[model samples]
Target: MDGPFATAFSLIASGDPALMQIIGLSLRVTLTAVLIACAVGLPLGAALALARFPGRGAVIVVFNALMGLPPVVAGLIVYLMLSRSGPLGSLALLFTPTAMIIAQTLLILPIVISLTRSVVEDLWAEYREQLLSLGAGRLRAVPTLLWDGRVSLLTGVLAGFGRASAEVGAVLIVGGNIAGHTRTMTTAITLETARGQLGLAVALGIILLTLTLTLNAVAWGAGQWARGRLG
Candidate 1:
């Protein structure tokens, strides 16, 4: 058998079209999902942290629990919802990139919301009185707390991205892993390894690892910058 590392490097250096396509699709889907999650999650989380309505505690508990949702279960639910006989089947999203985006977004929403809530809540506790004394209401204070806690919220976004990028179960069920279509890095790796194409699988794995590490590095740098500002 060819050494996996050597073969991986060779494939990468050769700019294999299939590998490039998989990598591109993976980035596009995951990044889009994360952005949509952030749009919904950040506002919802800030509201949860600032509001004190009845049943708020229960709502918070449910969201926190959902952070531990199983990937396969998520995939199953999405699959059912998008199936031909299912509720959203009219949209014809099943076995497509859109379905994959929906699946990943669902998978990461709870994580983003929970972590954002935690960060915003903590910052709100510190800034509440100050904001109130300055004539700021809860609505006005939400933005302030979110801005102050942006670094931590960013970390949460990165966490969601990581979860989206690494997961295969949900996307596989929804996307169908069609070549040059819905296939992504994680799904491609699974396909390659299953077909005993170790070199391609290893190459994809390396690319995935590199992307994840780069994201973490960016988060780390942002955290450091925020700390410096705080100091």
Candidate 2:
């Protein structure tokens, strides 16, 4: 443990190019996927909060269930779709960062959508009558509720980011974990472990743990801020 921790600290202190590259690609893929998920999920979730259509309960159930979708299943789905004989194969996105991004997006999208829906729905439940009295239809009230719920919604976003950053199976499948191309922190750690590079793997694990801790701290701070505002 001491030796591995020493190596981990040394790698961090030295800024090894390979380590930095893995970190950069991990951030790039995860951030892009989070952005895409939030962009699509936020408004859609707000709409789900406001909509009163039939079978809405079913839709909600499906999304809530999807929040638990396995990483490997998500990877396999992307792999199949991106394979040469698959419908989207023509785009040649398989075994690339873009493919990894897509896979992560799928994994995290349900989480974003489900949590956003819960936040906005609670806000709507409290404000619906007032919003209606103001001549604002349900559709027109979405943005207002979404804005008001922004702090709470941030927890969902950060959760999605954490999920994306930690996931190895999905990205590995779609990105091929190729050196200097698709390799990311999590996948690199997996490879390093397999090759008995325990020190490097432990180093990468330390970095990933730090990142997750930071994200959770941010989420906790946001929750506190929201509570203070409400108080």
Candidate 3:
């Protein structure tokens, strides 16, 4: 046990090429998924929170529920949808990086939407009275309100990215852990650990944790700076 642990530390210090590749791939997939989630989720969440419509509460409830969905369940759904004979099977995207990205996007979209809604909902409440008192049209008020709540909206994006980057189950199931192809840090770590390659696994694990930490720290600092500028 001690020997393998020591080897793991040593391998991590060596900075292996395979390790680098996995790390890079993980970042690419996570970033792509987060970007897609933001593009689709931000406006939808704002609409859900700000627009007056029938069944709006139900939509909010459904999104909130999906925000808590288990990763394995999401993975299974992706697997079925992309596997042979499945509805989307003709695309032939299973076991590919694109498939992993799609799965992760699905997993994180609900999170982004729910968090964005929460943030925007608060802003809507705070500004409703003031905007109405001034007789400002809802359309004119929306842009200003969204800008004022930029920090919170950014927080929601960060939350979604963080969640997507750290997720493993869905990515693993859909990506097949193919080396130099679909392999990501999370999948690599699992494969290495399963094969008793503890050294490589630990090294990858350390890198993964470090990357996640660095990204989140940068996001937090940026949010703080934005808040300061707003102030």
Rank list by TM-score: 1, 2, 3
Error of 2 at 123 (Å): 0.8
For residues 1-231, what per-residue lDDT tens digits would candidate 1 score against the true structure? 767677777877899998888888999999999999999999899999988899999999999998888877888899999999999999999999989999999989998889988999999889989999999999998778888888788888998999999999999999999999999999999999999987778877987898899989988997998889785
lDDT of 3 by residue, 105-174 (tens): 9988998889878887888898988998899776767667767878888777777777787788999899
Q: Cα miss at 27, model 3 (Å)? A: 0.5
Cα lDDT tens digits, model 2, 1-231, are 467777778888898898888888999999999999999999999998888899999999999999899999999999999998898999999999999999999989999999999999999999999999999998899889988888889889998998899989899899999999999999999999999988879888998888778878977987897789875
Quote model 2's TM-score.
0.94
Q: Count backbone clashes in candidate 2.
A: 0
Residue pairs with backbone atoms closer than 3 Å in model 3 (clashes): 8-199
**Model 2 CA deviation exceeding 4 Å by range:** 226-231
Candidate 1: which stretches are off by over 4 Å?
none
Q: Give residue 76's error in model 1 in angstroms.
A: 1.3
- The numbered model that scores best in lDDT is 2
- The residue pairs in collision within model 2 are none
Candidate 1 — number of clashing residue pairs?
0
